[model samples]
Target: MILAQILHSLFFIFVSYVLYLKYNNGVVKPSYIYSIVFCGLLLFVFNYFFKGLSNRLFLFLLMFSLSFVILQFMKKFVNVFGNNEELAKRKQLKVNVLSVQDFVFKKLFIGLICFYQLLLIWVPGIFEKMMENQ
Candidate 1:
């Protein structure tokens, strides 16, 4: 059970890493093929344990899409604030961006990342419990 949970966490880590790479480079690296395969294994495990396919698959699709969207937003925020030397000079972890709007967006993006991270942490366990319940 512990091993399964670890694998589940790895699934999220690998999937997010792959997405991060793909978003940055727009090309899939040969080395990450195995990671991709591991992710597929989890998906298959989900499919195998859960009897119904058509309806549940939509939920999975939405999960992946939401992840992609959050990643894109992260990239955009980084790009928007990434250029300034002033932001780089800051001592604290928090930065004071150019305007209130930028600050709000930055906080929002950070919140989204935190929320998504929690989702990644809990989702596999949720799937496992659901599978066991069936």
Candidate 2:
């Protein structure tokens, strides 16, 4: 289980890094990509640590701490990115320039990455099923 959680966390981190690269290359808007990556990392860490807590009270405390970290990250991100009108306009222009297919593909790719991470963390049985089905 620990190995599975580690692999899942690594997978999420890799996917988020890919998104970060895409944003840097102007393939996607930084605001959305950064937000998504931040959230993904938070979820990854939450799942990783949640499995280690044996006591319910400890688990709840860990979850609360994770929530606080997530909230603080978002607040800081918004402070840096949200109040900048120029950046917002530029990102909007970039988004507008994306083709429908490109937009759909990006969304689908992120969805798949997130789903795979969740499956690895919460439903290893599903992975076994997929392998059997194959």
Among all candidates shown, the one with the greatest lDDT:
1
In Å, residue 63's CA in model 1 sits off its true spot by 1.9
> What residue runs in model 1 are displaced by over 4 Å at the alpha carbon?
46-62, 65-134
- What would the per-residue lDDT of candidate 1 be over residues 1-134, giving only the tens digit for each residue? 34543544455566555555555455778768786676656655764675323225324533754665676677676775567566677734225444554544444444454446446445655645755798
TM-score of 2: 0.35
- Residue pairs of candidate 1 with colliding backbone atoms: none
Candidate 2: global Cα-lDDT? Answer: 0.50
Question: How well does candidate 1 match the true structure, expressed as C-alpha RMSD?
Answer: 8.3
lDDT of each: 0.54, 0.50
TM-score of candidate 1 versus the correct structure, residues matched by position: 0.40
Q: Write down the TM-score of every candidate.
A: 0.40, 0.35
Model 2 per-residue lDDT tens digits across residues 23-71: 3354555666576557555654665576631233223323433443364
Candidate 2 residue runs with Cα over 4 Å from true position? 23-98
Q: What lDDT does candidate 2 reach at residue 51? A: 65
